[model samples]
Target: MAGKRCLKGVDIMKLRFLGACREVGRSALLLDDNVMLDYGIKMGEPPEYPVNGVRPEVVLLSHCHIDHSGLLPNLMDIEPEVFMTPPTADLANLLLKDSLKIAESTGVNAPYDAGDLHTFMYKTKTVDYRIKFQTHGYNVEFYDAGHIPGAACTHVTSKSGESLLYTGDINTSDTRLVSGAVEFPNADYLAIESTYFSKEHIPRKETEETFIESLKSTLDIGGNVIIPAFAIGRTQELLMLLDAYGIRPYVDGMGKEAYEIMMKHPSYLRNPTHLKRAFDNAISVKSSRRDDVPLESSVIVTTSGMLNGGPSMYYLNKLYDDPKSKMMLTGYQVEGTNGRMAMDTGIIENNGVLQQLRLKLEQYDFSAHAGDKELKAIVKDFCDRGTKAVFTMHGDNTEGFATWIEEEIGVQAYAPVIGEKFDLH
Candidate 1:
């Protein structure tokens, strides 16, 4: 095969990194020369590029999250058909539509407008999770990534003989709403996400207990807690966790919005009945109007997790003036986001960046991505020979992930560069 002119005559799968190669956000990968698995996240991005012209044969969304699905709107004239699992489709619809409105009202233009969003939404073909289906030249299937509801680690095989797996923000732990990522058996190249590779996260149970107890203590002190969460995965899990309190606490309007998204799922929830019963008994739906101070009576879960823009910001605006109100941070707050602003100033840290900031804040790391040990166990089955190459992406905490994988597995792991292309057999 090596001696012959196979590369020119025969179809060979080549991977070109579109985004998410070294840093977090903007994840796009060109698979098999034409099929675009994801069209999102171009870091420190330019307004134009050459690969932008490559008409995508198909755009597969791993989940409805903004980072993975963000590029769909930016495509030029190519109206590539978009495909996602049913739950992802539902969540994407809501998220994109909401994102569209934000961009419009803020006078911030994005790739696609609301009309294009619906255009793609109407054309979206929703595949059921775990089922093998055919699209274009690829036979594809999905396994729950446990990162978000309907999120998946996609497996695709091209007709010309290339098979691969892409972990789209995977979580190895079993959580309230979804199952862990499925094991991969074969691939010429496995594109893995390394968002948390640098450091190990605290145990899930310990984090959850701390988050809840903090809220309970705040509530007991006659304080209201506002937890800004990504509407899809984090909100669902938090609802289930909060319901563990037997007294049946109140959920603000933001929680109601996420609950509507949950209702769109195909099957029964991955959460227990206690949460469902709590949803029935507790939970308050907030109004579109601001200025309602929800004090001492509720827990509000809203999104635009970083608090860049969303209903959560309005909620915060409503509560910022109230002394009895507290904000609980359940996930990572990016450097420049409002959540980070509130958190840094609230704590009496003498650090210059946060010294002048203001507000009462508390946080816990409850991210859904897999930690070190869990990631090792997930890839344990692939210890056998015959694997070709391993490339890691979507990690900022490059902390020691690359070295760890290389030393432990005896495989040469390389973190590729964004926008760089690689030749795969």
Candidate 2:
């Protein structure tokens, strides 16, 4: 690890890249060695955690996704005062508890136990969007990030008058679930995610139209359609879409719980009434209905979006050999996940064995992250407001994205690697 450096006459603070450098998960960053932003873990066979051993006085969380909040419980020993939105706290509790359950059932030693979860919850403080507060002598505020319910972008101003904005996981595109991220706060420095720097999604209306057309075609042929989606935001969006088109899907898995949690905090949603109507009209699949859902020509929306381990696997096991059935994926499939495997080789691990799937597979771009154009617009907007430096992270093409920002946007940019520290004066 490199040591922090300072110029003799300049007031300087250090920003350390603890994780999420040119990668998608395990996000962590340390500011001034005493304040942390998003300590999380990557999900895979054994899972990966953020760099360990640095203690912070406070943590500013951006969202509730596992990649942004998974490893938070591990900080219980330090007992950092954590701040997040009310809905994020509830959703994080749901996800963290499920992670612990999955670990116990698989016999994998979890990084933190129930005791750690309790401590994490005890140290958590909820704050609303646009609300300004003080922590460790620095002024802080939250902006709605438009990724999921309670997701936020954190802006912090040091006592010395330097300002920094950390966008945890942002979406500048509006979906049925939430609106685009709010206008960014003007700051001297910006740390933003580059998740979709190399990709641009098809327009939302056109994508939905195509999705509905395909669904109708599959259902018209008497084939059961399985839509695998992430429980948090994607599932809810699909529900509203399907409801609008008069298709009632059989809802399953953790999405039910996630929906219930989001409903408790309607202020974070774009249209809570529409979501509630969709939920009411949808059929909730119980344990007894699992074996029968695939028997009929039905539309099923289930979780473990990557087709990893969830109710999705059970449906896959029953329909993998059926040529008439279909499985539509609605999220980004990280490398090494079952979704990627299915997309690449038409094979997936089912019931502890490799199986070739005969069911037709398709992927739709329902991502909550901003696309290449939106990213450029965000950078330009920040630059127009006098942002002098940009630190890009959380994507495979972070280095290239940084280069583009420097060359095209005329700003100083860096894609810091894990464990690297930079001085901001």
Candidate 3:
């Protein structure tokens, strides 16, 4: 449904929410019917995607995370002109290729193929942050999102003069790898992520101390530690943290390649020296060397944070029967994932067989998203600048966040459902 004009002679800008409404994955949004923002997918046993058959004239990506930019390869058939930062382009390519390999190994038909990935790369154009450009009669710009390397918050001005901002997986808190997101130009319509709304993150220093202490305790007891992290942002950040705390970990999976890519682009990181130190201190694990990983008094950091695939599973299979060993999950585990199931119950399924885990399991909150206070600050910052409308998304509690924004922040806020459309003027 469209909103009525509150002012005379103002043009209407229609928005359609294709995904990431009250959920935290598959984020797709269409503006003015021609431009699309962030077409991604939800990772699970049976992966889910954004609404199909969207043939936008142009696509603006926010980051490389699967939940924000996973479905871009599928759009090769449409041949949409895609724009992202250079780092994002590199990371997305790495991740999509891995995704295709995983799909093939699992006997699942992927939506796109190697040819599609090549086409997607061919149509991609890299842009730097804060630089405005014209695309299909719209003025477009990107701001640093601070969630991951080259993540961005997108702003667009329609041909008819309406303005909109779409924040994709934002993190307004400084991390070891990246700085916090800062102010952007105000717009009439705002779409922001609410990943951590109603929750506050522990202070970074304290969290680091706790994590280090836990690792030390496990090592002291002659137990090996396994840290499952996302291949992109979280793995790199954890490596820095481990280096800072004087711990050397065995790095495995796509995270190893991801760090190599990150090293090539020092401009995208907060401190290249720290990242370099981490890489220097860590031991890189080759796939053929998996069986040689020391079973005692060692720390292993691997990818597939949700434990759905990757080398994390290989390590877990080897260590699951060791009572003294411990597994530390370093990221959010979506429901129905092996990681989540293991956390809730000491059981994990392998090859269609469920088995009880003897090793200890722990979870730490090392999310890259902004917390409640940060989300509120972002909303109030834009609200004070005369943002007329707000839409909360990319979380389970989107409706609650929208209500809070409307009632507490004193702005017109909405929690749109999937496939919902609105006309903003």
lDDT of 2 by residue, 1-425 (tens): 74554422245667898889888988999988888999998777667788899899999899889988999898889888899999999999998999899889988899899999999888999999999999989899999998998999999987777888999989888999999996788988889999999798899999999999998998888888999999899999999999999998999999999999999999899999999999999999986678766556899999899887989988888888888889999998887789989999999998689989898999999899999999889999999999878999899999999999999989989888888888887
**Which structure is stronger by TM-score: 1 or 2?**
2
Q: Which stretches of candidate 2 lie over 4 Å from their true place?
A: 1-10
Q: For candidate 3, report its TM-score.
A: 0.97
Stretches > 4 Å off in candidate 3: 1-9
lDDT per residue (tens digit) for residues 246-302 in model 3: 899999999988888988888889998999889889999999999998888999999
Residue-level lDDT tens digits of model 1 in 1-425: 01111122234777777777666777888886667877664322222222365677788789877778876866634677778888778777777677677668767666787668767877788887778888886888887777877888888888877777888888877777666765555765577888777568888789877877777876777767778777777776777777765544445434455567666663635654544565676655555433454456567776656666566666665566566667777777655455665665553222122232233677788888988677666554444534455668887754356667678787656676656666654
RMSD of each: 4.8, 1.7, 1.9
* TM agreement with the true structure for every prediction: 0.86, 0.97, 0.97
Better of 1 and 3 by TM-score: 3
* Residue pairs whose backbone atoms clash in candidate 2: none
Candidate 1 lDDT at 416 equals 68
